[model samples]
Target: MTDKTKPEVEPYDGGEPTELVTIDIEEGTGEAATAGATVDVHYLGVDFESGEEFDSSWSRGQSVNFPLKQLIAGWQEGIPGMKVGGRRQLIVPPALAYGPAGSGHRLSGRTLIFVIDLMGVS
Candidate 1:
């Protein structure tokens, strides 16, 4: 398994993100993602303020798979509104992310931003 922080981000030097934000970069024509659905996605994670890339599925050469219900709170909330083939940018607040405790050294007390491409759902 990959390290949790590998796909999240390094702890922000700044304070937490003030709110949750989602931007649809591309709208898809396929099924709308729903909770509990197994989804495949390609994502790039970065620091919202700095635009410093933290991780990318493209760099890894493969998409990742998981159930929407099992993802981080921000993803669980943001992704449900997306459809297969859609791409979205998510700006996650700390309360909806790793929170004050954080995920590990990289994501300690950090908010996060993710650009995700929905590939499939089952």
Candidate 2:
């Protein structure tokens, strides 16, 4: 995907999700991602409750490369099966995100929404 525009993540008003939710905005025909793959993606993250942006790779003018295994549970579960060039949204509950309250991470205890554009998988 060559588009550099950052995706807008709307606040979720449907209440906190009890499990990881994955929604594909655009489908891709490239190689599919797997649980053990390393992926390159551009993404935006927002607090589900506050509707405030917490992070964005678009802001940095670069995509990020990450090992799926090192990411949060939500991403590990949500990203697999997605193909390169796809744009997807993931709604992550605290347990699958930073974990429950007092997990030491600032986003702990809170649900998060993320818009991810898959660039490549290897």
Candidate 3:
């Protein structure tokens, strides 16, 4: 018999059905981050489970400015404390990600990997 626990390739869920794996940040946003707070950043969203890319700003060479708190729970918890011009990666679990049903545009039940670039905060 073969050992199924040896680990094998499976469909990527974007961390949608798994536990969150948090990466330590040299700096992170404080708990004071509020909604509508403006920030500049570039990010990439990938499916950690399936090893597929979902989104990325590096390819576009653009950083975006938006409220960190206004983003999803995972993003809210992922971003912050990153100094301007800093970059970081976040592994979001499914619970903290899109949830069970997933979302539109090929984002369903997937764990998300984000490489975020901090540009400015406003």
Candidate 4:
């Protein structure tokens, strides 16, 4: 695996809930990702407000595989159209993320920011 540098992302300030936002840092080559495609990505996940990193595949030195449909609404919606080798920053509203129910202790009722590297698709 090739070592990828971590991409920078803007943190979400405290605010009203809104839509998912995606910023393309690097445009990738080949077909755009779509629903039902399995994607392999390296991602750094951070708290939207605090900018504290909570998870990262890049830190792990490997990518993770996931079926698009099974991911969170934010990922399911934002990850599509990203080509292989692309880099994107996603600001996910709480509604599109863990939602009201929230996830684990750290992410309860919190919005999320992710810098994602699209490594492969199948």
Q: Which candidate has the highest TM-score of all?
A: 2
Candidate 1 lDDT (Cα, 0 to 1): 0.76
Which candidate has the highest lDDT of all?
Answer: 2
Alpha-carbon deviation at 67 in model 4, angstroms: 0.6
Candidate 4: pairs in clash: none
Candidate 1 lands at a TM-score of 0.79
lDDT scores of the candidates, listed in order: 0.76, 0.92, 0.59, 0.84
Off by over 4 Å in 3: 1-17, 24-36, 102-105
Weakest 10 consecutive residues, lDDT, candidate 2? 4-13
Worst 10 residues of 3 by lDDT: 1-10
- On a 0 to 1 TM-score scale, where does candidate 3 land against the true structure? 0.67
Worst 10 residues of 1 by lDDT: 1-10
- RMSD in Å for candidate 2, one decimal? 1.1
Tell me the TM-score of each prediction against the true structure. 0.79, 0.95, 0.67, 0.87
Q: What lDDT tens digits, residue by residue, belong to model 1 across residues 24-114?
A: 8778878988878888988988866666887798789888999888878899989986988787878897677776654564665666799
What digit string (tens of lDDT, one per residue) describes model 3 on residues 7-59?
A: 12234434343555555433443332334567776666777766777666556
Compose the digit string of candidate 4's lDDT tens values, residues 23-112. 898898967889889999999998877778899987887899999999989999999999988889888887888876436645767878
- Candidate 2: where are CA atoms >4 Å away? none
